[model samples]
Target chain A: MTMYVVGHKIPDSDSICGAIALAYLKNQIDEPAIASRLGELSPETAFILDKFGFEAPEFKESYAGENVYIVDHSELTQAPDDIAQATIVGIVDHHKLGDLTTSTPLECWIRPVGCSNTIIKMMYDFHNVEIPKDIAGIMMCAILSDTVIFKSPTCTTADIKCVEALAEIAGIEDYKALGMEMFKVKSAVEGTPVRDLVMRDFKDFNMNGNKVGIGQLEVIDLAVFDDIKAELAADIAAMKNEGERHTMMLLLTDIMKEGSEVLVISEDDTLIERAYGKAPTDGKVWLDGVLSRKKQVVPPLQDAFA
Target chain B: MTMYVVGHKIPDSDSICGAIALAYLKNQIDEPAIASRLGELSPETAFILDKFGFEAPEFKESYAGENVYIVDHSELTQAPDDIAQATIVGIVDHHKLGDLTTSTPLECWIRPVGCSNTIIKMMYDFHNVEIPKDIAGIMMCAILSDTVIFKSPTCTTADIKCVEALAEIAGIEDYKALGMEMFKVKSAVEGTPVRDLVMRDFKDFNMNGNKVGIGQLEVIDLAVFDDIKAELAADIAAMKNEGERHTMMLLLTDIMKEGSEVLVISEDDTLIERAYGKAPTDGKVWLDGVLSRKKQVVPPLQDAFA
Candidate 1:
């Protein structure tokens, strides 16, 4: 009767918090489920867990459970290595179906919302399960992080509604200020190795048969990228040399300004111009009001590359 | 905006009723949507519609609309030709993802229920919309047809709950007798061309690069297959000559007996044996207690072919 509820590898705040919130709701209904993580915790997620006085969910590197319920992602590649052999009982995600299949029918809930946490909140409201204040806080933080405080294009009416209710339940009055605090923890670049900073928020993509990647970091001030652009470029070059991707773009997003500056290294230099409708000057360009990757960044890149 | 709501190309009772019932609910909620069909109606669906004092939804041969919402099925092969250019605003389905990608995030609700009508009923309940008797009758028929009157393995508690409520709304005190009436229309083979009878409920599948198909008919007796097995074998052989499928099967399902007799035609004879764990004598075999194609027939064939 034990079910392991987990999210994607290279865990973001939404994926991590979604697992926790969904497991809580499932357990309230007497479905024996435990929240777990697949990959390393991002700084913002770690910060949210610490503030809530909750330990991080156990890290399940390998899945050995009889029943597994995936949250926040449906990609088999992002799941446990032996997921193909395991019994997948359910999936709750907001991303594209990455060609995942089951030997039998299972419970699948995929919505087109800004964050998976929004769906989890709706599930809570649907079943009349009262969410705990700490769970509400983290869920709100995850929604705020994924939606960039409702400034991203992916935000919907459901997300905004859930955010308002969850913020009240979390005893938070100003969500914008909470969003700023989360970004402050995420965007702080303190003399860390350029390689570590680039890979922290990195995600790989397969664009028209070529491997590509984008790494984004949010900051209050946009000057963070200007400080170490050269060293970061060197690290990206080393990564490109590994043949993992043909293109690599590092995004330094200014959360306060609600915009992003993208630094690029690509053989197809015109791709960024075609995707954003502006040419990159000196291997860097500013995309106005481009704050979400799944909504704004990856889709256009996929189109241009295709 | 006029949104054309339609089902898959091979329209089943669930697909037809789901489109009609969903369109009714959406219009009540102030969304301008029309229930349309992609293919001709099956006899059982037409019977249900006629019994409910409703006309068959207008046939939509080609899509020329701005917004389209799909139900019952998710495959692009079952969608309109212009679906690639159209904006898919919402989807309420109960099947696997068919690799359809939209340019942006949109509303999607996919569950592993027995029928799409079950999900639509839940949506109605979620919105607190009362179901009309006509709509309830068709929805009940859809649930009964797809789940084989609650005898199929895909049936769940949620489905059973919906059926009970809908039966009361439809003024049916005895659903088993009503199911027999529907299946009497479905299984009526009086002088019907074997090709038409087989193709009436046929659905094609791609199993690991191999073309496969299944057709089912609900009858009161499994012995009826012995009369027309030769004609069915010839028509299916011609179907194979058309290069559509490597394996084609006709399931003579007895709703009362709760079993089926499969008349199969395959170039690979061992495949049928391996899929069902026994050889077919004279091109037919009685599969005791086998009712659901999605749950029983397709999965094993997918495994055998894969």
Candidate 2:
């Protein structure tokens, strides 16, 4: 049987690249596996795949009877529509433990690192399997994108070490330049649909039975979103109502400024105030030094909701 | 700060030895770690520890305000009462995924093997750390007991290979004889209280919001429980009512016969019937070739309850 290795919905660089890399490793070690994605890829992931001379994985949503190895994320909200019916053969994630359960034992390799690709790199080393050059290139880009070029608080020494080793393997002496190029593609907000912009890099969280939606748009400068802020807020409000979520947020992150200006559409603004200890002014809040949503944003909101 | 490594509430041989071996590996790799236990030792575990010239780990019931690494099992019912408050640093388990969530990233090493010690042995190989002789002895015994000396369906090639490697490290020429010795100690039930016998190797499961308790007693012959079957059933019934559990069961496994005679007490007897395709007569039924509660038992029961 061909086991499908997939990543979360609204696929990011780490989710797409980690699924491909993990599928490669699984094929070498255990079974015949195929790399798959749950949704359309972001521009950053597309650039990384093209730069590495690789194609995007096959898009597959429902995996009802197939064996699956999940990558990058484990939350049910981020998974496929029929994920409960699929047999989760393994998981390689760097996020907090999510509410996914299996009846049989599984191969779970979750580490407190910056990127899932970092853990996949460790797996390749453990099995003594050599990584192909193109795969290493894409994997290195994933680590860079997830860590925001080692500026995010989620970046760990392991991620840095893995990036260095992968760069050596891919023969890329200037990976930082490559990261900036990918982010440039990521930051192109012009001519993009407001719903697409909001859904790009978006994730839903189930906090104490209340659905919360969060999205991030990382750019070189926050000025890029100055004209589109109202449109983004209106789209977020529409999405919140459509999904019946208690709150919906869009983070306009300036990588150069090292902070985020958040747009909030919430049922009760106090939930946000209690989480960040800063009340939103006119449905917006400026969170200084907040670049990584997984590290800085989700945890406090989850705790406050609890 | 010392991180404590512990196992499930009713600490089996795998739980106790896995905590020790993993703590040893963590100390060599990362931080200060100590092996601890959630409850008292079983006869088989006691014999293995004594024969290996090792002491039982410190008993700790609550782990609030401490960092913890769980082994053997991950279900909240099997964890300490204050596990929700404790910061779970990591987990090394071989059972099905349980309902445990964490806000931070953790080091999770879960696999579909017979024993947690097998995965720990893999970890030791991955880190290139040498295991001490006595630790290897206890680890070998843990695999042997969990696999029923390689007679269990849960036993895999990885488990057999791990046991062979551990036996060579411990310098044990006849490991099967050692396994038999351990089982002999485990089979001793004369003059033991009924509640203690029922509680030995007990584990609780949350089956679709209904609490189900199950215990296993492995003996050389089925006749060992002939005189105590009635007493065991009564104790199980009392435990079920007191705990407000939907069902409680005890599996009297005969390793020599390669089958288990189950004593069941449940509010709905048809749940067992739907699971195993057998109706209980006098609250007892023979389950041929059912040696693993995790593999042959829990999944079907959980599905039926769902």
Candidate 3:
């Protein structure tokens, strides 16, 4: 029987690496497995894959009607995949779970570990599977990306152990350095459309019965903050016009400062006030020492919504 | 010095429990600690906390200018609280990290375990702290919610072990059953606004240079699907009218059927056709044996996007 390993929409490093690692692990157990990308790899992910000399996996837009093993996302978006033909034998991921429908025998592994790659690392460790250096590097990168280099709240001990082991295999020290380099290369704020920047690494939050969208960009220099502020402001306004029911907050954060100057465009001034006191001059609010959105911003905004 | 423990926006069970657990742990070390909720607890979380007889923490709108230990969510939204006053000694979380701005004596523990509660559980085990039955129950419930009762792609052995131990302390023999009950209660899709349903529990993804939003609602019975379908169709059309640049797909998954009937609402019909073989007669595509958005639907749609 063949097992197809796949990741969620808008494939990130964790999604991509998780698919590859699981496929490799399944192949070791004599299961015909192929790693598949559910969406086009981001440039950041593409760079990581290229560094490892691996081609991006064939993209599968939706497992909606096809049989496949899932990872990294929830089960809310299931499609018409024939599970009888190809049973979803296993799953490895890091995101919150949605309801899943599986008819055949299923051995699911869903950990809140920062990345699905961490689970694959555990699988490899448990089975003693030899990880290729390139794969190891990819796994390490995935861990770094998903966990923000062990800075995110979602990270776990397993994530740390996986990174440590993969670092040795990949011959890399100081993932933070590598992460900074990656962010620096990608943080070139010039020429990129504000819409694209707004959508980049963006997520939706339900705020006060409204669907508020937030996007975050990390840059080494705070000067980039000014570069994108106007465009972000216009784009956020446009996003609200474009059907986002609530507010759109764009953050251009300085990694070094561990703080951000927020650009918030919202129809509701109350939300702005509730979230960041009064909107600051220059369309920026000083978030004293806040850095991670998941850590600092979301909780309070969620409270306002509640 | 007192340390305030809080979580990111839309604080889930993990965020709340993690705050409590971290506070409890810090108190063991004689640190002045207080657990605060950034948002109102979801029904599922409320159920867990009520079951355990623990009062919900006070809600805070933002962590701006406060000394805080962030959990569940990242720090990208707001700045880290000014730890200068009350040394923000450590961080324990389970989400991706964003930029952090603290250089004090900080002990950051970011692991990718299934739940932040697991990290607290580890600390409990390490310190030999008695697992209070109420705390144990809440932690276990948080695990179940975050991991989707071990059905999410993110579950790990540590999560399992933690849940097992906590279940014993909580006097619950069948967590699976309890989880199912919780899910059943949470997934009930009656009288909820389609927009709110869609936005709640939604995360953003960066698609191939396009901005796309996907939302999922878990329904126990197919009867409610028609109402949800109608409401969502209008909402999607409104979203498109408001100028949402990309597509919006909503999934109404029936847990019993182990499949989802997808509602494809987009300006581009071809994108839907690319993911699902053909547009349904009612714009609703029936995906058989396909459940799990991350595994089945998103990958294929991502492929179409690519």
Candidate 4:
């Protein structure tokens, strides 16, 4: 048996769904392939899998034991397996390579498109595979999620083609309507804890010899901002007090506004002023039309740091 | 500004990433298009975006408030503001159709590939659009997810063509290695809760006048099953005691084995025996080379029920 272990780190629907579908495909070809997950799934992802009658992936943190194949997360540091035993025979990813090195000869497919799911979709298409309805739903979901329902700057033509084909199999139409329904379920604010509300999927970044923690909260109703701003302020202050090295930023993005209300909480008001060109008193800085953090916030912060 | 909301539902990387790419394409054609997320992202998805330094989607649950240019997940349930006010010009998806009524003439694109991300990639190829690296990463991720790293049954020829083109742009080779790495991550078990392990993404079905709750767990080390079996049994028993209407069934799928260990837990032992031809004593039932529930298990169960 040709035994191979495959997985994606910090798995989403695409990673999970792709792993499952590919494992199925490999088995069909009589290759012993296993699909694994590097992290826990979100509740929404769980809901999606349940709706489609699929299971969540098995969680594996690192590829330590057997032959390892990497997916979307390309950093070699994330996967520290014995490179000698683990000959990286293939790679399927949709991200710019950060720092990945393979000692063995491997087939690497890194496409600058929308999602790695698109590549998996294309592969299936090339092979003329007949996707089951449940797996088809997963492919459709992965495309919708990564492309922001075809709205992000990172999307590609291949992404659209894959979605069109998967849509036909999954029996879905009016992606906008389905997207709306799914988003409504996700953006619901009922019975959610305030801490959970403020600190979902937070990330830490270094800027100007200081580490900054950033958190994003998506809100369907802008009115929720009024109820949560003070609580969010306290949460930011607490994080700063808890020995966080640098400034803290919270982005409350109003989906309806198509913009974000940037809140920067820092001990050094000058640093906040330096980044945003306005000093914020009481540990608060609000900026309008600041949705793309990479394009808008990160660049300005990097410039200020420089 | 003429704004058109474009989106997909329960989206994966391809849907969201494709939306972004297509939105960019539309903008280049002088159409003001905004990409939106229909649901929350999974962890793997967040990792993909973070690696490429792209923003998470602006969450929009519905297109009821504005004019929508549909993408991956379009199904006509609720009408948007005005079909006349906004020309429903373009559509791109990969799922099966579900009642899309558009009176205005539109460019409809629904392909039978694995993902819409593939479509977007093909569009870039068709239009000779220069794919940015970030977009490439997103689209590749979408393909990997949707096609299960090229192992799904739902793939087509167009999907392959797009991925091949995208591979050149992203500077990657050996997709199989990458897919293996991703799947390996899914099999590692660390801090996952027992309840989560037992009940993760379970689904329900009707079989022989009985409600059957079927759950699947992917595992790399079969040795882990020895440790987890007792806990799984207890969890199953607890669920049975909860007065739910279903007989709970769990399948511990050994992806490498291309088989599963079926565990049937129910008050009705006769039903278990009737389904699998034997009552699983000591809480374990072994099945040889039974991996896919849809292909291998569901059919037998359906026949037994009939």
Task: Name the better of 1 and 3 by lDDT.
Answer: 1
Candidates in descending TM-score order: 2, 1, 3, 4
Quote the positional error of residue B192 for candidate 2 in Å.
0.5
Question: Which parts of model 4 have CA positions greater than 4 angstroms off?
Answer: A1-10, A25-31, A76-91, A126-130, A204-212, A236-247, A266-306, B1-306
lDDT of 3 by residue, B193-292 (tens): 7777665554333455566666666555667666556877787667655646477777776666656777766667788778867676676788876555
Q: Give me the runs in candidate 1 sitting further than 4 Å from their true place.
A: A64-66, B64-66
> How close is every model to the real structure, measured as TM-score?
0.94, 0.97, 0.49, 0.45
lDDT per residue for candidate 4 within B1-306, as digits (tens), equals: 544545544455666677777877666667777776666654445656775678876786645436565666444422232432343555576653323433222344555577778877766654567888777877777777556565454556666767776766777676556545544554554576776666543544555455666676655446676776788888887876674745777888775665678887766667656766766778778776665453456546645655
Give the Cα error of residue B162 in candidate 1, in Å. Answer: 0.9
Error of 3 at B79 (Å): 36
Total backbone collisions for each predicted model = 0, 0, 73, 175
Best by DockQ: 2
**Which number leads on TM-score?**
2
Candidate 2 residue-wise lDDT, B88-180, digit = tens:
989999888888888878889998999999999988998899999999999999999999999999999999999999999999999999999
In the predicted model 2, the residue pairs found to clash are: none
Per-chain TM-score, chain A, candidate 3: 0.81
In terms of docking quality, how is candidate 4 classified? incorrect
Query: What tens-digit string does per-residue lDDT give for candidate 4 at A1-306?
Result: 343445444455666777777776666666678777766665556766886888776665554446555655444433434443454545566653333433322334445567777877765665567787778777777767656566654567888888888878888776566655555555665577766655553545555457777776655566766876787788777776685647787777655566667677776667767777877656665576555443456556755765
The sequence of per-residue lDDT tens digits that candidate 3 reaches over residues A174-259 is 86788766767656867777777777666665554577777787767778756667767888888877874578788777766767
